[model samples]
Target chain A: MDQRKDDANWSPPRQHLEIGDSPADFNTGRVQGRRLTGPQQGFGQLWQKTYKVAIPNRTPEQIIATWKAEYGRFWPSNSRFYAPVTGIKPGEVGLIKSNQGPVPLSTGVLVLYSDDTSFSYMTPEGHPFAGFITFSAYEDEAAGTIAQVQLLIRTNDPLYEAGMIAFGSRAENKMWEHTLRSLADYLGSSAPVDTSIVRVDRKRLWKNFRNIRYNGALPWVRKVRSS
Target chain B: MPESRIAMSVRAPKDTVRVIDIAGELTAFGEGVLTEAYEDADRPGVKSVLLNFEKLDYMNSGGIGLLVTTLIRAQRKGQSLGAYGLSDHYREIFSLTRLDEAIGIYDDEASALATT
Candidate 1:
């Protein structure tokens, strides 16, 4: 499939998110009707993080195919991703129930792009980070085939920004590292995962402080506290 | 399969504006050239860095990510970023990614330059 064709692999423009036939048992409603946000719209300092692991026997296409099919299974134990019935195609919305602090954070991601060797997710307005997370597999000169995840993101709001600066960043890093390790293990490789983080911008967008109003975890935390 | 390649050349249309004429597929493979081109166009006294996408043939999600990074770099330097010559499809891409909010998009180079 040529990526340049009109509406080829890119998700169509959407005004609000809409969930498809996902599991009914999972908690929902935080993502529906929310607008998608990119790193440019986020509040905190921009950062680009990359995590990679080499899988010796698998081809890049084979790795991506498995990753897309078993996307949720590779996540850490605390996270649950409910992919749509149509799988990880462009424009598909996937619901997520993940832990943020002690409370459950219910949000979702839009499949922004997908190809044979790579796929990307864009977060909704209230996701912890506003940006794109791309999972790809490529053939490297030194390593036969490398599976990688790269994120270009910033915290969605001031509170999330503070949380990220405090401890959330470390947890996020560990989560991805665990994911890569799991993927490598699943693919029958013991290669060590390599990680890199770069701060793309130092300044925060103070204007987006109001985004805290849509924080998904805060309401749950407050409700638990008040009860 | 042929390798994807992208090239960017900096042109100073005026003292305050530098335009980057981009060609080829703007993917992760083009990061080095894009960064170098951006730095070259981001010389002192240049307040606006506009991208020319007339010759751009293909772009993937990685390309969109690169654009966002470019936008951040421009914002950090206090320079405005704009783009022109995008096909309707690519323009829609900019909208989908919400990049249209931060970077000005124009139909042609003349219109983009006229604004600056």
Candidate 2:
């Protein structure tokens, strides 16, 4: 078999997530030692979502470079991505403290792959969604540079699936739309973002229904109830 | 670096199994080809679909996502999906992404065909 050097762009095999040096302000407990989960491991219906915006002047490489350098700055105000000290490279873990409805959900993602034009994140256990989200920039003949965020996700558990059906799905769409708009605005573009969402699979994995035990919002909600 | 476009061909070596010989890079660009090849291989009375990745040069996260989608497609059709000829690097990738749980990995064509 021929071995290509592109292997370096992928993260090394890991049994569980490990958070390295990150800021003290970030909540890092939920991700440490938790196993990574993909769409197959999730409990809800599978979804593929894509959001893209055209940037007039930048190249794919330039757009990707800026996207990597300022990854969290493009998020909606309610979401906070705490990038690791090593930046958005392969094998690094990043913490996320974002709001899901009224719940302040804390979770993290593993940087699964990274290169000049693209990077992808795989969610750890207990995240609202289990899947991969890829950010990429590509050159288009007519549109010039296009920056895109594509997600293949399923809700992590029954509770999250209920939340997703209630309001989380719409909020998730708005979140990415806001992120793409923020990125485009920062890169000197006001182009309208294009969004496409597809339900890839309608069946839910009943086996993974137990994943609700690790839901990050549970502890927070319990704390509030006692307070 | 030269551009590497994905190429795929389907063949049924036996009544129960169909093999997709995939070559070149497997990325988003290969989606349509992969889908077409998979459809061709998933004919009636075929119980298993095996992917022959000996000629696969490179694969990214997008390619991995494609595989997941393929697995979903196979499941929906009540057919099993397996793969062989993956390099050590990609084998590890399969483990990391936990795709190995759903798709069987074999060392060669004979081993994959013998089981399925």
Chain B TM-score for all candidates, comma-separated: 0.95, 0.96
lDDT of 1 at B77: 89
* Residues B1-116, model 1: lDDT tens digits: 12558878999999999999998888876888899999999889999999999999888888998998898889888999999999988898899889999999999989999999
TM-score for each predicted model, relative to the true structure: 0.95, 0.96
* Ten-residue region with minimum lDDT total, candidate 1 chain B: B1-10
Model 1 lDDT vs. the true structure? 0.88
Q: Could you tell me the lDDT of residue A114 within candidate 1?
A: 91
DockQ of each model vs. true complex: 0.59, 0.55
Encode model 2's per-residue lDDT on A30-122: one tens digit a residue.
Answer: 788999998999999999999999998998889989999999999988889888787999999888988648788878899999999899999
lDDT of 2 at B62: 89
Instruction: Sort candidate 2 into its docking category.
Output: medium
Local error of candidate 1 at residue A224 (angstroms): 7.9
Query: B1-114 in candidate 2: lDDT tens per residue?
Result: 123388899998999899999988887768888999999998899999999999999999989999999999999999999999999999999999999999999999999989
| Clashes (N, CA, C under 3 Å) per candidate | 0, 0
Error of 2 at A154 (Å): 0.5
